[model samples]
Target: MSELINNRQERIEVMKNLIRQLHEGRDEEKVRRQLESVLQEADYSDVFLMEIQLMEEGISRESITKLCDVHTKVLKKHLDLTETPDAVPGHPLHTFLQENQALLQRTAHIRKKIAELEKVSEEESADVLMKIRFLLNELMDVDKHYRRKENLLFPFFEKNNLHGPSTVMWTKHDETRSYLKSVIQALNEAENISQKEMIAFARLAIEPAIESVEEMIYKEEKILFPTAMDLLTEQDWYDIYLQSPEIGFCLYYPEFEWVPEGGLVENVEKIKASDDKIHLPTGSFTLEQLINIFKTLPVDLTFVDAEDTVRYFSPGKDRIFDRSRTILGRKVQYCHPPKSVNIVNQIIKDFKEGKQDVARFWINFGGRFIYISYYAIRNDQGTYLGTLEVTQDLTDLRALEGERRLLQYDEE
Candidate 1:
């Protein structure tokens, strides 16, 4: 036992030293090799937490991040014993990687354009600058990638008491966000920036943001993810895997197969069976009956669970907003596209913390105006139960002149 503990400690020390060396500008390949050897021999999940700490200490090594991905591939292969096949093309990880591939290709094209701009005469750089800004706007997808992690992945980690890596990664994510904003602001404010100024801005803003992302990959693979794998049961991972498609991935695709635990599968089957009928406080109704009732009603409805998972969405045939069953059980953050995730998250947080009760929005759609409102649902003790989202097509409602004394029937 003593010898085993000593070996673990020695491996941890070596990992820390490699990170320190990388941070100090030592040969990256050499440090990476040393770290790789330690990782191969170590119980990866156990030591990954320590590695995350090293990354948090300012070691932004590209080689280390690359190796970390390699490590994940290896560990996943070793631990994956199920008969299920790998995720298909449209799987969350696959979709995420596909999106990332496009983003990376775009970034590369932008970099080349920026380089070409430097070569051109100062009198003709405006076009290139405009293209650069457009590229930056496209690059805003990184914010979406980060949101998937923060809202979906981080909550799982928090449930497991592994807050260290998630917190550090969130801080780094915010730094990247701020850097992107600063670069965009600088570009917008410059009426005529010299080549030297442009280069400086690229180095100061873009390079560091990219480096931070690389380092985040390191921390996730070496620490955050491994710890999650250790602490989370197979069912827990399966739940994440099932819901991941809605939010998407950051850069790389995880090509592993995930099979839910037998117990989880059984439980889910039970839920599905029971879903045929709903027992309310006053009465019971078949699922189909409930659906018909909600669709015929004047208002649309959506239900988010106490855990903030989007559990139910009433599909009114003429829904004021679009929704899909795919988004059911998804974190509310993932349901919205990247640009709106922050606002969604803020609303959810406020709702959960009991700081706010109602949020409303109005919009015009297809010549008809609509109103949407989210209400925090609570129990008798004021304990939050979930949220009720109501949306109504208000075009007719807004035009109402007076209360109708007699009912009129329209052809069905």
Candidate 2:
């Protein structure tokens, strides 16, 4: 904590010990005091090393995630935006920072609305609820921000063996997603909410959800981004930038065109790399043929692997439900509305337990009878593989009382 111990390695060790103490039930005030004292002489790298050391001590990333923002709140003064390096336009980091600023403005506006709602009468609250719902929808875009981090940025961190923070941050993302879902549900369930109910909803749902998002923004800027800047090279960042649009942008767009060096060559090589045939027991097909066959299927198909990560989805011309590359490798639970996640979990559990091999649901949507069925994809030995979700619009099929054996296209 003294200037005499200002050697980089010594400072990193002190910071590491301080973090371990904080985690091991040391007095919070004492640890914070020590951290503050160290920050006076500590370079930012010392703090980054602290995070790496904490994970090295065998602590779970989930546990670290809960503590990440707490410690960062204290370090905010030390890691000023003015002092941290700048990210260029179109860079993934720059886009994220801009989105956070946009989110802050939007959240501030919602808070003002919530303040006004405190005085409204029960009879007049319905109009206010509708307005609040729109604001909540805007805030819901946070998912795209978090998803890009999980799918694009996190993988690079893992590649460098900096797995703890990525895992920890993803857990926090799930928490924020859960909170957002509850806030949406609170708004949707009540048609004519009373002033008291509206205030209660704000207290119970809105504030916490927005606060979770804000805290995550702080963590990313104060700790995650700085460390990542030091860890990732230009090529690593370019790799993420190329994949950014797949998950979609957040509240802002990158106007400048930025391309990675050799990016086109790398992509072309990937395309040509899989030209060999894939042989199966029945027969063999080239990769291109297999891709076309999946796309040509009448029903939209999605395969969620045993790990619950989406491994594949067919690109039908008219998909019953929207599917995007963003969904590739994403957790199946996050793909659905949070309300239905429990039902999805139950179905997966039943499949794993061998209680059921299939689950089907049909709903009339937009005058179309949309049939959705989930089948447990398994091997001949009966081992659980994953879930295959097949969806089709059956409006025309149901109306047909008789089958026509011959194809006649004169009507066209």
User: Against the hidden true structure, what lDDT does model 1 obtain?
Assistant: 0.65
The residue ranges of model 1 lying beyond 4 angstroms of the native Cα positions read 1-6, 14-47, 51-96, 121-124, 158-161, 194-196, 218-231, 241-412
Estimate, for each residue in 264-295, the C-alpha lDDT of model 2 and write its tens digit: 55663664676668889999998889999998
Clashing residue pairs in candidate 1 (N, C-alpha, C atoms within 3 angstroms): none
TM-score of each: 0.49, 0.62
Tell me the TM-score of model 2: 0.62
Candidate 1 all-Cα RMSD = 9.1
Off by over 4 Å in 2: 1-43, 49-71, 74-78, 83-198, 201-206, 234-272, 337-342, 401-407, 410-412
Error of 2 at 150 (Å): 9.0
Instruction: Kindly give the stretch of ten consecutive residues in candidate 2 with the minimal lDDT sum.
Output: 259-268
